[model samples]
Target: MKILNLFFIGLLVSISSLASAQSDAEIEKMIVELHKPTKKISDSIGKLMQETKSKIETEIDSVVKENLKLRSDTLFNAFDDNAINELKQDFVFAKKYPNSLAALKLLRRHVNRFIGMNFYDTYVEVFQNFSPEIRNSEKGKEMAQNLQYFKQSKVGSTAPSFSLVDSNGKTISIDDFKGKQYVLIDFWASWCGPCREELPYIKELYKKYHQQGFEIISVAKDDKQDLWKKAIEKEQIESWRHIFTSEDNKNIIKNYNVNGIPHKVLIDKNGIIIGKWKGSGENNKHDLQQLLKSIFEAE
Candidate 1:
């Protein structure tokens, strides 16, 4: 793995050198060429590993031995930490054997740990460095397009004010909840899976703490009234206010830089954004609850 790290570091350096050249065509050509051999090797190893279960142990051993030799010949000669880390992450020895998926999962866990320890860049940098094609990819595009909203939602920044019609069509603004010690302006839609999954927990939290000066103002982005109504009724989400942002209202979405559904912004009574933005699931509820507890206790 260390050797593999060195190999990739060398490769990145080699590629970086070509960046000074003015030709996009040349750079594209080089990217293709450089990625080709590694792709072939990776594909072959993946295929063999997928079939390794039916093979004898001796045959597996032989394959492993051959791969190590190939790796030594191609990768071990390099000496770059970042490159080596990338290569090791991309290729693990256990990937050649049966039950490789488990091994690969473990390898991924370790790789994530390593990256978390060393690369503490914010999510913006992480997304920016991703391949350009990623933005065109389905989920990638959604995230990329919404990056502005997420980035603007900083702790000290002013929470964007909006006047959205509630279920009964009355317009309301952030000022309505002004006196509350904490307010969670959750942006969601009726059709979102993660939002639906989070409803029960959110309801529980809301009910448990609403009297303590915590208010949850839910704004749905659903275009259809019936489905939105059905979800609210079914989920029994009795928050402080349940408002729906009109589908045609591009300004609100653009103002918050909301690119994804189920987005949330927690604002303190003083109107400072405090909690992390949540786009999906119940993952952040526990943290939010803890924060609320602390706030209430402090007050």
Candidate 2:
């Protein structure tokens, strides 16, 4: 009897161990099922992110196309005198597409080009009122530079000093004539037609006022020394000192802020600039003559 009871006790112990092993395997399977759902959720999120990105790109492309079309239409309508007015009207449309990079680019281009066509003061006012970040952009830098250069080219500013070699290879500096009553600094080129046309009038003025302490300094922006000499001879501009500068000489040009040819600066004896003349129009000639006469009378 005792042997039979021991055998039964051992059999019961083995059965209990088998039941515990089965329970552990079932728990592991439950854990794996929970992890499977997590992986599915992760994959779903990734697919959704890709779809969202594609949608955003497609929308951006569509906005760009529309903005380009609008710009084209606006430019086409800008052929008339009412171009500025039309541009102002289209600015409302540009504002509507705020935050669109394509629209902002188009708006900036049109605004900058329009500013070039009008008063610089107005441009400055408008640009200053714009978004600060946008105004500091690369395009904005160029616009500001243009405005500054234009402002510096105005009359009554101190004429920039320069030194160049005369026809005899003697160095001449604008400061050399500082003690005189007045000085006329003329920028000319051998190939400039208007400069040649104005030579006779300049000669007349020099001959009349030269003895009265008036001096003329003609600076030639010429690449060829022979052509420059020939022009000086042909024009009979002998009373004035003639000097030539090389084609690559940018310092003088930048100092004067000269963008066009036939520019003249009138300076007082104290090295202070009094007036400026630009271009070769009839109005410019008349203005120059009047100014010279006024200066002579004042002296």
RMSD of each: 17.0, 25.9
Ten residues in sequence with the least summed lDDT for candidate 2: 72-81
Clashes of each: 9, 0
Top model number, lDDT: 2
Residue 256 CA displacement from its true place in model 1, Å: 1.6
State TM-scores per candidate: 0.53, 0.57
In angstroms, how far off is 106's CA in candidate 1?
A: 28
Cα deviation at 158, candidate 1, in Å, is 0.7
Scored by CA lDDT, what does every candidate get?
A: 0.60, 0.65
Model 1: per-residue Cα lDDT over 147-239, one tens digit each: 455445555677777777777667777777666567887888888987887877778878877888888878787888789889888888755
In the range 278-298, model 2's lDDT, one tens digit per residue, is 666455567778888888867
